[model samples]
Target: MSAASDIAKDHKLAVFPAFHRVADRKVVIAGGGDEAAAKIRLLSETSARLVVVAKTLSPASEAAVATSGAVWIDRLFAPDDLADAALAFAASGKEAADRAVVEAARAAGVPVNAVDRPEICDFYVGALVNRAPVAVAITSTGTGPVLARHIRAKIEAMLPGETGALARIAESLRETIASVFSNGTDRRRYWERFFSGSVADALKLRGEDAARRTAKELIGTREHTGRVTLVGAGPGAEDLLTLRAQRVLQEADVIVHDQLVPDAVIAMGRRDAERVAVGKAKGAHSVTQERINEILVERATRGERVVRLKSGDPMIFSRAGEEIAALEAAGIAYDIVPGVTAALAAASSAKIPLTLRGIASSVVFATGHDRHSNVLPDWANLALSGATVAVYMGRTVAGKVATRLMAAGLPATTPVAVVENAAHADERAFTGRLDDLPELSRRSDVDGAVLIVIGEAVGEAGANAAEPLAPLGALLEAA
Candidate 1:
């Protein structure tokens, strides 16, 4: 395998699947409250046989059970009740009881879902969009179900009902397709194009025959050879990703992404896309970059549409230049898709303006590379004019950064913000003056995609930090 193929495996983990199947299998629901009714409603279209065992079932739940003829134990469940279950769901209010049921179910080789409790879940009950043969699910990994449901509704709105019709038609004609495209790679390539285009739109506009004809055209246009696209994964949030990035991910033959790319971002690619995780964590070299650049260039030259998913905009300090250089040298077709970098995410989350009108109009982004030479950037000439300066991967060397800035005549008390794991849940931001930066960093745990910003713009943001953002948040602020 080429070096690019290996790096592709390392950086591709961002597009992992978020859903799986347990079709025509038995699942045990051991609860009596309204929770059981909700779970039953969700499973109404699924193939799983649901058994509800509770001391006292709600009247509505009992009615649902009666209508479905679902087995109701009408009492507490024993550990052995899970023996034949492929999956289990428990919603008992008692934490201890939920834990016991979850442990028992897992011991029985059954995946368990405890309602609203992340600690007890073996898997998760995600938000869903049911269109049969084409069901879609949106999950928050149990962090925010309401948010998940809202997002699922949006996704459901985006998908046309014709998608289900298209899926059914494909299934009915599967034998013929398999025979026509004998090789698995060719078959995959064919479907990748078929699903990518306006087949559903064509079927809605005309009929299945027209859609089939279009699918054939797509198959002819696609080569079975593999290609790699070096796409920026855009920080750690799925929403932070660009439309172009998602479009590429959907078409990616293989994805090599940074580890800092959120798990949710990785799940954006096609369900079957192979994902690899390369450590792109700032300041830590896990997969030496020479190998990654070679991987992208080699894979693309082979006619593969490989996506190189970085943590942020590929152009910003992200070795996009090096990879593009290799691709250009080899005459491979590729393009860069910009994304929300960690600095922007951090600045927005911390409510610090890297640049603001009058307060600090000019912004500078620098690394700590001058430390070995004991050289401080000319802060007086570059930053003394009230500009915001953002330092990427400079939190560990905060003391040196501050000393140089002070020497350059920037205020010792210039507002500084240290953001860790920007745009992610449980993200922490430390705000202080340059003088107190080192002590603040010591007291906090800064890990995973850290960034530093120093300037008066941060202080100006503090003036109206509580106010609502302007209509042009993306333009006015970096969020």
Candidate 2:
């Protein structure tokens, strides 16, 4: 077979679409009539310097030229007017004048558009949906102008007004993106998320500043290699999640979530995302912390978008520090997005304020056990400091916490509130004196995560608070 015959044949086009750089370049219009005005109107959207050469100006052309920043020359068209121009429009209405302008443009090597006379034109102007920095052009190569305009209208309807804003933000981050992602594949993936993912949505709904901020955050997260994000799952409630946390979940390639993280929250991630359940409960460790760290580093090293989804705030007793340290040691890019910790959710569900103006001036968060599973050192001293103390993961060490607080001068009659599965549909709350805290924490029906609150601030939540509050929808309807 001949070399040319071996190559597959491709369909040919009557006219190929091409975008020419015209910013700050000269554009000449030979007529000052309705046709020329229309072309000028389109060119006004660009940064091109317009020069209008005509013996007489119609009122419509005068108005268009005035607003379009075009320099008007009150004289007949000449070949010299096309000098240094990137484009020329011949719209004098008279065939003789239009032909002359087209001939001059061809001689000067300038592409000319002859309005309503495509046969003599060098290029046909398409119907444009002008979202600057993100334009969509529709053309039928002069064969069907009306059809191209109809297509342009459909596209205009589909795109948001803020599309240009999103495009401009992406353009601004081009340098940063180039520096962070070394390979073309990584760079392309990064831009795919920037345009079609959360950043693009943020621009349309929240405005430019929010979109730019989100774009920067996504850019800072992963690098040439894969990276990990430590996201807080927020007390087992999907709605309580921070916007940033939700965004990361949607973009994650692999989610390493805790066993306690509700399925509903995990379901918010991409449908095809890999889920690795490494949940650790009381004495049973499904995946050790060290192994979890190794998993994060390994997946990230392979250029995967890994999300270490933890229950509650990762910064507060969720062992996020160890994971962060491991990632840092391995030289992987990582970021943290905090969520609504259990203490805050528990207080909100029980209708007990963690800090009251005069009753409790300050609030403290403490895990019932230290890293070694021993009673937290000096935790009782914190309870005696006239501050509301919220204890996390304290179901097993509730008695120790209560006994030590009492021994350290905190009154035994102090109010205590315990919330299990806070903010979830099956949430439960119990309120009693400090001496009864151990019993409250050990309830057989409380199978979910537990949070214990001790101080005068919780005095108003009665024991009957165990009755789950009305759903938020019901409360809103009642209001």
Candidate 3:
């Protein structure tokens, strides 16, 4: 076999992901242009000793080196320049010079990153989401840096700003905690409690001392009190979930979720926690509510943090009332974490305002299905209420809902929007008059959850729906 073919057969090319400890180490940069200046600014944030080698530097590079206190070598790059360096960067803006530096760095056993030249690069500098001790790096194997940066921006927004401070607090208390809890399992459990409990909250709100005190108190009393938290998983999309709901999921020792709750949302819970699916579908009840209540009570009473994860806002047609009552009657402590309900998510996805000042001053949320009885809610008053009506689980009975509204003096021409799998990747919205709802729902082919919005606000949305809203990333791109 040919040398290249033999090498390819023996080993596949792949970029191994890793974090190099460059603190107090030397990093050599051979360039005098904008690319070199950019690397200098990034390396300045770290504790690395930066050395810039260029016969002449541009104004930008000179200013950056001056501000960063990087050592300047006013001479041509030499092979010995890579000696004892942790890493090397070649952004000379000249192909010949960059290639020379890369060859020298490779000879010296140093990893080199050649800007805009992936073929010669030993390492590619990807996007960074710097939360200090909680830094996240994203890369695309030198195929697409822009794509990597976009992903980084999304993660940066999701991570709490206080994460670094919380990490610092944990580091300071690590020795004390280790001493207190000699067993490794007990130490891990204590740290999990610390991260999910009032210590982290105190760090966010009341600062370091209060958080320290809270941590100390937790150590003094290594007691586990079980509680049930009713969390809303939101409308399909994981990002639509509230921060409080995410935190509670991370802290859960047991997650009890419904069929309506998406798997992506359920996966956000602590990895080691037991997951029990007590989901209820339209006609099928895999697990009955009475049985579910028993499970919650049983788990919580056993000193396990139980999470009753419901789809969308738990308060809105999610049977949260029944569960809350059950917990209360059993004297099990519980709390509710609100989430972005289907109505809100549907409206946002369809670009429809639920309530407008002149068009719809109030909004009414109601369920299409009534499990207690076949009798529906008062349609006449709701039709006359001059409020936007957002119906949950209404796809099956869209025809009947339309008929009741029209019979109650609501115009057949009133605009309606049916949003299926709101805020999800497969989300689709159909806009038409109230009379068209049944047909629209039938043609939608949506097997997932569906929400219906009917009123003047929907009519206005249909009018201006042609204009697409700008994406959140547009601001970052503009910047």
The model with the greater lDDT, 2 or 3, is 2
Report the lDDT of model 2 for residue 451: 86
Q: Write the per-residue lDDT of candidate 1 for residues 289-402, one digit (tens) a residue.
A: 788877777676666668888887788877788887877777776767888877787788887878777687788877755636443575546778887888876766677777
* TM-scores of all candidate predictions against the true structure: 0.55, 0.56, 0.81
Give the true-structure RMSD of model 1.
13.4
lDDT, each prediction: 0.73, 0.85, 0.84
- Measured by TM-score, how close is model 1 to the native structure? 0.55
Lowest summed-lDDT stretch of 10 residues in model 3? Answer: 463-472
Off by over 4 Å in 1: 1-153, 156-185, 197-222, 280-285, 370-380, 440-444, 462-479
Give lDDT tens digits, candidate 2, residues 435-460.
Answer: 77666445566666788889998886
Q: Pick the candidate with the highest TM-score.
A: 3
Model 3 spans > 4 angstroms off: 1-13, 242-247, 286-294, 322-335, 348-351, 356-358, 369-382, 395-400, 420-432, 435-449, 461-479
Report the Cα lDDT for residue 119, model 3: 85
Alpha-carbon RMSD to native, per candidate: 13.4, 14.2, 7.9
Which candidate, 1 or 3, has the higher TM-score? 3
Residue pairs of candidate 2 with colliding backbone atoms? 226-303, 259-279
- Candidate 3, residue 344: Cα displacement in angstroms equals 2.7
User: Which should have the higher TM-score, number 1 or number 2?
Assistant: 2
